[model samples]
Target chain A: MNTAALHKNESTKPAPATVNQYTFTPRVDIRETENGYNLEVEMPGVDKDGIDVNLEDGVLTILGRVQPDNQDGFEKAYAEYEVGNYERQFQISEIIDEEQIEASVKNGILTLELPKHAAAKPKRIEVKVG
Target chain B: MYSLERHLFNQLSGLNSLINGLPGGTTFAAPEGRSRRDEFPRLNIWKNDNAVVLTAEVPGVDPADIDLNITSDKIGISGELPSRNRAEGEAYQRLERSSGKFQRQVDLPFRIDTEKVSAECRNGVLKVRLQRAEADKPRKIAVKAA
Candidate 1:
């Protein structure tokens, strides 16, 4: 229902809280490393061509469509999961540089590089004696 | 579209709807929206007496590329699924299968000793054995005439 609560939900599928929602969305791991925060999202069946990244204001968003092989009139014995689009939104802080963000889709896991902004980075400045 | 819990609830309501005049009434049918089936890998879960079996259809994953983690209540499979596609020409059409990093976590209903959890990957099928802890095993008591 709530995005904040959805974030805490153990069923960590990245999609928003909707009805009859296809929750095949797998859980993703977001960890903060010494350099920056590393997001390792599990997005299987998504190709590089189908994936897209967008940054607006201070928010970063990733979207990808998982298309299936054409198998018409196929009879399924049973299916416990559903397929569809993959979308995730993250709040970006001043620490991350918007222009320097680089992304790559290897296999299905899309790795996005958010380099630390120059201002957010710590720098040493000598004290000037008046 | 919905949370896994909601999906489960919808499924449960569908199952409940079949039997009318029960505690709950019919809800909505399977409404389609954002489909996540394509987002994650194809995984199957089976239950047995001693342990719960899990298998994931990982076509490109190497045994060495897979990582396994076991805890007191759950098991995690994390690793990179291989994906090196050949260059396509005019004849190339569509690519369906997925590759790259994948991780799956399954929670066992019954408590199991994590130390005893054994896993083996063969033919892209990962078999995890979650042995039930001695304390959680059901014990049979002697029947006495009262």
Candidate 2:
């Protein structure tokens, strides 16, 4: 779609609470399910080889670089947007299976599955009254 | 002498906070404390010789979470990523993952063969390849010498 119109659509959606003072940031979508949670992040110009996903200090981080094909030493005549690296971090609690958390990237989308530990699942209690 | 260099390095870091930093862009920082459900999603478009390649990034978002639609010239991608709020008493050091409505509407730069705009999702990325309409493609003319 005319990307110009896409930009307009972004403004029509509720803006994030705070705008990035300066950063080539990716938009995010979060979801919760009965078994676990998932995080989907958008990285437009990033590629699989350039992406890095890591977990440290209970924080999961996804990072990648976006560098279009080089100019063969030719300077760009006109430019409006800048392509750079992208980084996003998340703080997760005990509900996730630290050892089982999964990650995958395709078509610039990164999918992380933070599955809950077996004991973390909800159980229906049986009620018995004498 | 080496100790002096180390001291100078520390001082330089303090002085160069903004000077050496990226201009109009910062290293992405993800938010904290929201677990297994919070995700950031994305979409992309690239023009090719005979087709337009469109990609959507849906990290941690299952294929079932996405919906794709297309017409002869317009395409829309929509999905609902489940949401899970932060647990109480947990402090979020930083949060960069975003969750909510994510939609992208792309207009074809050229007329496309809508029936052939193939789409698929695998490993979290949705790819749509749109081929040009037959009428839009250039055809060669045969010349017969009399």
Q: What is the interface RMSD of candidate 1, in Å?
A: 17.4
Which candidate leads the pack in DockQ? 2
> Model 2 reproduces what portion of true contacts?
0.09
Candidate 1: stretches off by over 4 Å? A1-26, A123-130, B1-146
Q: What are the Cα lDDT values of the candidates?
A: 0.51, 0.53
Residues A6-89, candidate 2: write the lDDT tens digits: 110112122223343123445454445446666655665566776777776666666666535333323332222334456655
lDDT of 1 by residue, A6-58 (tens): 21122234345454444333234443333444454545556778677887776
For every prediction, compared with the true complex, DockQ reads 0.02, 0.08
User: DockQ score of candidate 2?
Assistant: 0.08
What is the lDDT, from 0 to 100, of the residue A97 in candidate 1?
A: 71
TM-score attained by model 2: 0.45
Fnat per predicted structure, each in turn: 0.01, 0.09
- Measured against the true structure, the TM-scores of the candidates, in listed sequence, are 0.43, 0.45
